[model samples]
Target: MNMKLFIFIVLISPLLASLSSFILKNKRFAEYISLLASSLDIIGAFIILYFVLNFKPIFLFNNAIAIDKFSAYLILLVSIVYFLSSIYSISYMRLAINNEKMTENEFFRYELFFNLFAFTMLIAPMINNMAVYLIDIELTTITSSFLVISEVTEKSIEAAWKYILVVSSGISLALLGTILFYLSGNIPGSANIVSSLDWTVLGLNAVYLNEGIVRIAFVLIVIGLGTKVGLAPMHTWVPDAYSEAPSPVSAMLSASLENVALYGIIRYFGIAGKSLGFGYPEVILITIGIFSIFIGVMGIIYQNSSKRLFAYSSIEHMGIITLGFGLGGIFGTFGALLQMLGHTLTKSTMYFGAGNFLHKFKTKNIKKIKGVFHIMPKTAFLFSIGSVALIGVPPSVIFISEFLIILQSLKDGYYLVAVILIGFLLAAFISLLTKSGSMVFGKADENFKAERGDFSPFSYVPMLLPLAASLILGFYIPNGLHNLLIGIVHIINFKIK
Candidate 1:
């Protein structure tokens, strides 16, 4: 049980995948190698989770790397999406080669940046220094921007630029907030001064920090990280980027990358709450969370493109997660954390299904993508089931998570808040199902053209795996996961007080 060995396995696997893919430039080698790497990382992540559950938080490399239950949980989520996306990419990129006119160089580029993007996100939560963590997040932006333009279209280029410019600006603000956090502990004449930028140290000494600085810094952190989280007012980049990226990359972005960014924000939320009292930051998260959900549902209602429809759904889900955290109790916080897992499992299934539709119909427009059930029966069946789960239907983990959050709001006596939340949830539930149902059950055009069969098993297998996992979790939450989630709640709650 060498801790460092497992850490090395998790971090280095993706880096090696990125390097070998670019160096060798063989398509099949690149495809299978990426899959092999993700497989290894997934096993490593589970081991890390098991160790964290039974033992102590791990700090290695002179404390430059840290992994607590919270970090372990996030790592597991990222690895899950990484594994699924890699499998889906085999079918996805091959189709691009044969049908979408993708060059070998572009495919090579996709594999290179794809694994690197996962590597960056994998490292973000493990880093001890807040500033260094921000740098890693920025690296994800760079690698993912390349992935966004995998098809090299006008729309893809614009989406890449928009993704970079907007998210980079957000990261810059997060950096400033990190600097302010450092200064908060070193106020000019404080005898009990600590000048570390490591969040572990800052969080432990939050009570000694300057309250005024913590207040402003927390706001900046939320605004900054919220952009990456796809929160409203700062969520403009999300729709374009998610729509333009390949389905695998979109799953990584929506399912994994957003959770990584949010891990940073939640770290600060605890620190800021401890510094300035739980009340101040709770209001901020609650307010912004509500607004983001509003924006997300509106976008979903109006969305015509299949990918953009789900992009807005990401925003809505993130908002619910934030709102759950804002409510600040066991149910609220635990529900939010569970929602992260639920979202990751369900969303990847969705994007893979969407990828199938895109390949079959040769379009992103929902109107053009009708009668998926007619063309790709397996994909349409899974997509339809996934849509039901995505909308928080019963026998889905999302239903449990969202219901817990509502229960928290009611227990806290925020009646209006509960009502508003239920309203939006209802709106999103109806709107998304409508869009997906039309595509699944709608009539195919008289002159419908593409072949009437699903793509390779690679396309649909990934969908089935996660969909089944989500359904099982919904039916029965395992004792181990229940404890792990409770441990994560303690991780956040223990610091906030």
Candidate 2:
């Protein structure tokens, strides 16, 4: 098949699925359509990745759309989460309708927004124009915020409201930054650049951009997109949105959407590094990265809700990734990219487990839920292992990434930064394990008899797949993935020698 054909399918499948789902809202087959659409997207993502590795970056629409290794990898990540979330939704939405009094209309709306949400994220990484990419990120916010309110309680509505308002404000700031980027290009003594917002154009002409304007624009980009990426200080809406959204939506938001937003920051990082030198952007990334780690660990230490606990963990992991990119050596950049994959796998697994717990135990409170090992043995086992992996346990992909990051920090002679990184990692490890252990093994309330097994194969299987992959990749990264990460590192153009 022509690669553009696949790209078209990748971009169009979800819209078709969303429309089909809305029309077929009364039918039980809507979920199957969703799964099929996501399956097609997965195939398309692989095709794009394969072509990018073997051939060249795929371009369409006169360069308006482009898919390189970095973009392909992101598409694959988003598709993977979308596929799993679709499968898990089969059981999750059913339970919501049967047990939680969720109406059919609410379920239908959930499917509609769910497919649209995935669509927005899928197209984001493929856009060649940075401005358009940011617009797509904003669209993701709007679509996923509706998913946040799928069940429409007061809290869910509030979460959705906060999500839209904060992220919109952040995006507005990013727009100002983007305009500055254009202005930098159009300034005096600079040749008029028609496509200033195109990443390709900006990248090629980065040296010509006004230095002071570039600095200010980079900061605005980070702050604006950082809000969407769930970086702290801009992260207040994240916990609420993740906690209140349906588990499948929460999984996508944390596992895939944040990465999509972060992709924008990293792109700008590349531009800024090219224009203003790596040191300036590196320092900015590292400072925010460390502070986010602190805030996330603190939140995990005191969290009472299971969903919110993982939300904080997401922030911590994002911090780690940001720090890795900031460190800017082969090890640091490679570790950060690897951490992105590890996080997508492990965090999604953990969220799936949390979703199951919510369905089976009817609560998100950490204290109220107990003896998951007895209530749902398989989910408990997987969730426990996922928690360990999430905290960088040995033989998990996270461990490798964290280790690589620490090695880079030490190698760079940033002794204090290394110590702080390790301290935060240890803190997160202890706090997360303690919280998950309690939920898995704590005594069940005397009157809390419910079920004695997992929700469905759909629920636990998705958790197991990612957990197993993380474990295997920890021991060995396949050649294809290794090369893909290397390609991305090259694209980021950071080297220490």
Top candidate on TM-score is 1
lDDT for model 2 comes to 0.92
The C-alpha stretches of model 2 lying farther than 4 A from their native spots are 189-195, 494-497
Give the TM-scores of the predictions, in the order they appear: 0.99, 0.98
Worst 10 residues of 1 by lDDT: 488-497
Tens digits of lDDT, candidate 2, 1-497: 48878888998999999999898665477889999999999998998899999889888899999788999999999999999999999989988988999988888899999999999999999999988898899999999999999998999999999999999999999999999998888886657553458887788778888889999999999999999999988999999999999999999999999899999999999999999999999999999999999999999999999999999999999999999999988899999999999999999999989999998888999999889998899999999999999999998999999999999999989889999999999999898999999999998787987757778788888899989999999999999999999989998874443
Candidate 2, poorest ten consecutive residues by summed lDDT: 187-196
**lDDT of each candidate versus the true structure:** 0.94, 0.92
- Could you give me the TM-score of model 1 versus the true structure? 0.99
